[model samples]
Target chain A: MRTAFIKSLMSLAERDPRVWLLTGDLGYSVLEPFAARFPERYMNMGVAEQNMAGTAAGLALSGKKVFTYSIANFAVTRCLEQIRNDICYHNADVTIVATGGGLTYGTQGYTHHGIEDIGFTRLLPNISVVVPADGYEVDLAMGSISGRSGPSYLRLARGGEPVIHTKPIDQSLFGRALMIRPASDVAILSTGSILGEAVAAADRLTAEGIKTGVYSVPVIQPFDAETVAALARQCSLLVSVEEHVTQGGLGSAVAEVLSGLDNPHARLERAGVVHGISPNAGSHAYLRQLHKLDANSLVERIRKISNLSAKRSVKIK
Target chain B: MTAATQTSTSLARRIRSHALRMTHAAKASHIGSCFSMADILAVLYGGVLRFDPSRPDWPERDRFIQSKGHAAAILYAALAETGFFPADWLSTYSCDGSRLGGHVTGHGVPGIELSSGSLGHGLSVACGMSLALRADKKASRVFTLLSDGECDEGSIWEAALFAGHHRLDNLVAIIDYNKIQSFGSVANVLDLEPFADKWRAAKWSVVEIDGHNHDALHKNIGHMPLEAGKPSVIIAHTIKGKGVSFMEGQLAWHYKSANDEQLAQALTEING
Candidate 1:
């Protein structure tokens, strides 16, 4: 995902002379291509995230399409005020690229986790919060973000994650949810790099004679409410999945939309990290399992919900 | 005083008088802050800044950002007196639905580069603008005026270091060292005594001057880039609430909006 972001940014810089990149010194090996190709437009802004964000806004104010890069919270949380006042208020043409979203850096401890970034960024006005499911989505997101003239937050995980889409992704479908499977009994709506887990859980559920559908929602803000509502109508149970905390991430976003509907067809269930800091130190897989974010845990949770719903229907009859 | 100094001094008096009335009418604060930077704004808007009032968005015009945004009264007065908009707009300052708010904003107002009520944001933004102008090979320069109390913010130094390292010679920072802050004196709160040294050590060319002296302001600011390869910072020592005898050097004026009698007295002193 990180590799895809850099390649897309490099292509953007080559085409637009106004494209500039500023980093808080976190992109080590991945950003070399961009830095090497456009030395004049690239700047390593030292360990100061505040300065990098403010400078990005300043550059954007001067008619440059700027991107500020750093890892996780450093890119969004550290200089949040700058993003709020300097960038979003002015409607500057800047994209904030946050790498290592969620528990991708689990071994690095909770400090590196970007659990609350989506919540913090989505509240700001004039900013599009995009959490791509895979490398293909990242490319499509890059094209969409650069084509527009406003602020955007691109949350990416580490590279070498499984690519979910087999064929070419349509650029027009960048901000909309892409359905990987059709729904009959249950549907799983997933966001960010956790889409792979949702797909796996769906396959497992399907084999168990419980038909399930999966939809990958990459854009969390300006959410595809129509698709989500359509899915809710089709399925009896709608489950929202993400690698972030359940409070303000994708789960909460989907819930907010569903709660407003006149007659909600599906019972919404959210699968995400529990709210609070993790006490144990481990790898990505361990953390995911502990938080019930892994495919196995998701499969188990959905089966339980399905069984409970079936029993409730019998009671109603 | 030369003719130019007389003109700027007159402009400064108008800014102070307008600010006094605007604050009193709106029941707003920061009159002292407005007085401290009045002369600097006068000299800059008088002739030093390369801007045409008719063309506020001119590509080649020099950009000025007021980082000490609480002094919106005087900034709006300056813009109005310089014909960015009608001087009549001064009456609507800080009123409900007015474009002129308590803090400086550029939302609907002309001649404002960035909206700032938060300290430590202006210099970094100025550094960015300077870099962009340089990149485009445009000769336009960027200048930002900051308050001494506002320098306490860490983001200011972050930008200071960035500007020096990047050799953003197109940027100029002017500090209104008025000695007073929100709760107490700047010295009692946080001493920036070694302020000029800090800026110099960061590779910027430092200059110290009386902020109220229009001649000094014009002489120093009319010239570009104090050094060939360094950003410039001018530390202008000023008195809070300078023009009015009753209010000069009084810390209370920082948050005190003048009553009708006080406004009359201040207006008399400014006109005198």
Candidate 2:
């Protein structure tokens, strides 16, 4: 995903002479092309996130579309005030490309985890919060944000993430959720790199004679509330899956949308990292399994729910 | 009307008149700071900055951030004097729901480049603006006017180090060293003595001048690019209350606002 985003940024630089790329000294090899091609336009702001955000705002104020790249936590949290005052207040055309969107940096521990970024940024007005599911979606998001005005936060995974969008992603046709596979009995609302797990769960459910419709919501801030509600009404059961904390991640956003509307029949369940850190430190894959954010766990949980529902129907009869 | 005396006297008269009127209307303080920095603001808006009042967000306009933003009346006077907004807006300053609040805001005003009340943040924002212009290969400069007491902020030092590290020559910071903060004397509060040496030590080319002397102010600004590969700091020494005789050199004015009678007297003194 990092490779795709860099390539997309390079492409943007080629097209728009006004695009300036700034990094807080994080991208050494990944940003070489931008640094080499447009030395004047590319800057390594040297580990100062506040300065990077302010500089991005300044560039935007000067009529240039600016993008700042940094690791997830430093990129968003460190300079949040700058983002709020300089960029959001002015409504500057700046895109904060935040890499390492969740436990993608798992072994690196809690400091590197980007779980709360969406929650924090979602509260801000006039700033679009985007979480692209895969590399293809990252490319689509780049196109979606180009020639766009106002501020945006793009949460991205680090390099070597699986690709999910098998074909071209037309951003206009895309809502917060995309129905990857259709289902009538249950609906799965999934986000981020956890889409692979949700997909596997859906496949397992289909084998068990339960039709599942999976919706992928990439844009989390100005989420397609209309689509989420519509999908919620279509199924009796709605389950949200994310590789983020349950507090305000994709689950919370989806639940917020579902709570107010006319979805009385909808039984909602959310699957994500609950509160608290892991006791042991290991690779991200081990962490994913420990948190039950993997496919097998998701499938087992859904199967158990399905059995409970069957018993409840017999009790009603 | 030679540039030096004409700009000084005209701006001083406007500053005194407006400062008296704004504070009188709102019954607010910051009158002392306004009076002290009036000449400096005059020198900046009248002479140095490249801005178009007609187009507030003009792409090439030189950026100005008032780090000591509590003196919105000064910037308000400067902006109105420059025709950025109507001169009538001065009357509504600090009124209920007025855009011209006690501190500077970019919401309704055009010439206000950044919203500032937080002192140390402005220099950092200005430094970033300069870095951006350099990165974009634009020649426009950024000038931030700071109060002497604001130099005590750690964030200011962070920005100072950054400006020097980046060698941001296009960035020019001028300190309105009136030597009074919200508390008592900056000396009593926290001494920023040897302040010019502080900037010089931080790798900024330092220029010291009488902040009120239009000739000195203009001369120092005239020598832009003060040093290659270094940001420039003009430490303009000024008084707390410069033009108003009753308010001059008194720390109490920093907090106390004039009554109706004092307003009448100030108006009389300013016009006279």
Candidate 3:
């Protein structure tokens, strides 16, 4: 995903003279290609996130399209006020790229985790919050990012994530969710890099003679509300899946959409990290299992919400 | 002194007088702040800043941001008196439905660059402005005026370091070092005594001047990029409450609005 994002960024810079990239000194090997190609456009803004954000806003204010890069919270939360006042208040043209969304850096402890980034960034006005599912979506998002006139937040996991989309993604589908599978009245709406678990959950339900709607929503902030509302009408229950807190992530956004609907039978269930910080730390897989955010967890949560008696936990296979 | 320099001095007096009346009417604070930077503002808006008041958004115009934005009355006065708007607009300052609020905002107000009130934000934003201008090969410069007390914020140091690190020679910072702050003296609250040294450490070409001296203010501010490849910072040491006799060096003036008698006396002192 990092490779694809950098390649896309290089191409965007190559095509447009207005494109400029600033980093908080976190991009080591990942950003070399662009830095080597366009040394003038690429800047390593030390480790000062606030300064980086302010400079990005300044650049954007001067008619340059800026992309500020850093790992996780450093990119978004560390300099949130700069993003809020300097960038968003002026409505400057800058894209904030946050690598390591969610628990991609699990072994580095919870502090390195970007669990609350999307939730925090989602509250700011005039900025788009995007969480791409894979490398293909990352490439597509990079292409669309330059065309976005206002500030935007691009959420990505650390490099080497699996590719979920098997084919080319159209530009029109950039801000909208995609349905990869068609099965039942129950819909599993997943966001971020956790779409793999959702896809597997849909398959689990399909084998059990239950049709499930699997949608991968990459753009989380300005979500496809009309489509979600349209999907809400067909499904008995809508389950929001994310690798973030249930309060303000994809789940809360989907719940907000569900709340505005007048459908009598529509029910919304959110599956995300609801507990306090994880007491046990290991790998991403270990953490996901401990928090019950894996595939089986989604299948169980979906069944519980849809009035279907979920099979015994051990006998799921 | 030349005619323009004499005009700048007189303009400074008018700014102080106007600020006194506005602060008295609106019952707003920061009158002390407004008075301290009056001469510096007069010099900049008088003729030093490369600008046309009618063309507030001109690309080539040198950008000036009032980072210590609580002093909106003086900024508005400087703009209005210079014909950015009608001088009549000064009467509506800080009033309900008025474009001129107590804290400076720029969306509707002409001649203002960025809407600002928060300390330590303006310099970095100005640095950004300078960085972009240099990148575009535009000769336009970015100037920011901050407060001594506002330097207590960590972000100010961050911005200073950033401007220095980037070699933002197109950028300039003027600190309104009035020796006084909100709660107490700047020394008592947060000692920035080695302030020039600190700026020098950040790689800025530092200049110390009496902020109230019109000739000194004009001479220092009119110039650009004091040295090659370095941002310039002018530490204009000033009095908190300037112009008015009773208000000078008085901390009470920081928050106090003038009574009728005081306003009369203040205006009398300013006119003289």
Candidate 4:
């Protein structure tokens, strides 16, 4: 994910002179090309995130499209008020590229986990929150928002995550949902890097003759309300999946649409991290397993929710 | 520009008159802070601050961020006097649906750069603007005005350290040392004594002068980048209510809104 982001930002910088890159004394090895190519436009504002965000806002006011890159938690959380007042309030054209979304740096401890960024940033008006599903999606999102007006927060996974999209994803479908797999009985709404596990869960359900569809929602805020309403209408039972906590995340966003609907028959179940910190710290894979975000746990949870075994037992004529 | 110096004193007097008129009409307060910074705003709008009333969003225009945003009435007066907006708009201050609120807003006002009411946030924004200007190779300067009490905020130091570390030569910060805050005298509340020393220690080129001195303010604004390679901070010593005799050096005036009679008296005292 980091490699793809660097490649994309470098390409965008080459094309747009207004794009300036700023970091909070981080990005030592990854941001070399941006510095070398756009030396006049690049700045490392040192360890001050508040200043970095404010600086980005100032640059945006000067007709310069700005990008501030740092580890996710530090970039957004530390400068939360500045982002709220300076960028979102003014609708400045600055992209807050927050690397290490979710538990991408799991071993670094609970402080580094960027789990709640979506909850806070997505709530602000005029801010488009993009949670790319994979490297391909991340690359496309970069191209879409480079010179685009208004503020945006690009939540990225650190290191190289698997490239999930087979072909080049259409960059213009920014706020729309993608139907990865289709079904009528149950629709699974997934976001962020956890879509891979969601696909595996759908496969397990399919083997047992249980019909389920996977919906990858990359843009959490300003989600395709029409698509979500249509998906809810297709299924009696709706499930939302994400690596973030159940509070005010992808599940919460989906529930917002479902709760307001005239249809009272659709029941919603959410699969995500619950309250409480992870007991042990380890790599990203280990943390996912510990938190029951793996394929097996997702399958078991879905099985319990749908009661598919009993349905399978009643054989068709 | 000679009109700037010739009419600057009267312009400063007009700012005080407008502050009294606006605050009384709106039934709001902040006359003291407004009076204190009148001459500074006068010098800025009249002499320094390269701005055009016609093109408020001009890219190369010099930037001004008022950290002590409570003194917004004075800014509105100066901006209106310079034809940024109609002087009649000052009547709607603090009224419902009025853009001229008690605090400065960037929405309706021209020449105003950013929306700021939060103290200690302006310097950081100004530093950011200065950094961006350098990156663009534009010689535009950024001027930030802060109150004495606002320096108590930790974010101010964070911004000060950053400006020094980056060697932001295009940034200039002026501290409106009115010696009084909402509670009481700033010295009795939080001592910024050794304030000049502190800025000097932080690698800034420090200049201390009477904030109301028009010529001094004019001279310093021209001689900015005080040193060849440093950010500059001007410590402008001022009376809490410089022009008005009744409000001068009185902390109670910070919260006391003027009634009809008091407003008349304030106008009369400032006019002559």
Q: Give the Cα lDDT of each candidate.
A: 0.91, 0.83, 0.85, 0.83
Docking class of 3: medium
Question: Lowest summed lDDT over 10 consecutive residues: which window, candidate 1 chain A?
Answer: A308-317
Q: Which candidate comes out best when scored by lDDT?
A: 1
Q: What would the TM-score be for candidate 3 when compared with the true structure? A: 0.95
Question: Candidate 4 regions off by >4 Å?
Answer: A308-317, B1-3
Write down the TM-score for model 1. 0.98
User: What are the per-candidate TM-scores when only chain A is compared?
Assistant: 0.97, 0.95, 0.94, 0.94
- lDDT accuracy of residue A66 in candidate 2: 88
Overlapping backbone residue pairs in candidate 3 total 4
Once fitted onto the true fold, the runs of candidate 3 whose alpha carbons sit more than 4 angstroms away are A263-265, A307-317
Tens digit of lDDT per residue, candidate 4, span B1-272?
A: 45556678788988889888888888788889998889888888777888888998777878889988898898998989988999999888889999997888888678789888777778888887887788778877999999999999877887898888878989999999999988988889999889999998889999999898888888897667898679999999999887777789998788887887887878888987
> For candidate 4 chain A, which ten residues in a row score worst on lDDT?
A308-317
True contacts kept of each: 0.62, 0.36, 0.62, 0.52
Ranking by DockQ: 1, 3, 4, 2
Ranking by lDDT: 1, 3, 4, 2
Worst 10 residues of 2 chain B by lDDT: B1-10
TM-score ranking from best candidate downward:
1, 3, 4, 2
Using TM-score as the yardstick, the better of models 3 and 4 is: 3
**Candidate 4: C-alpha lDDT:** 0.83
Model 3 agreement with the true structure over B189-238: per-residue lDDT tens digits: 98997889999999999999999888888788888888989999999999
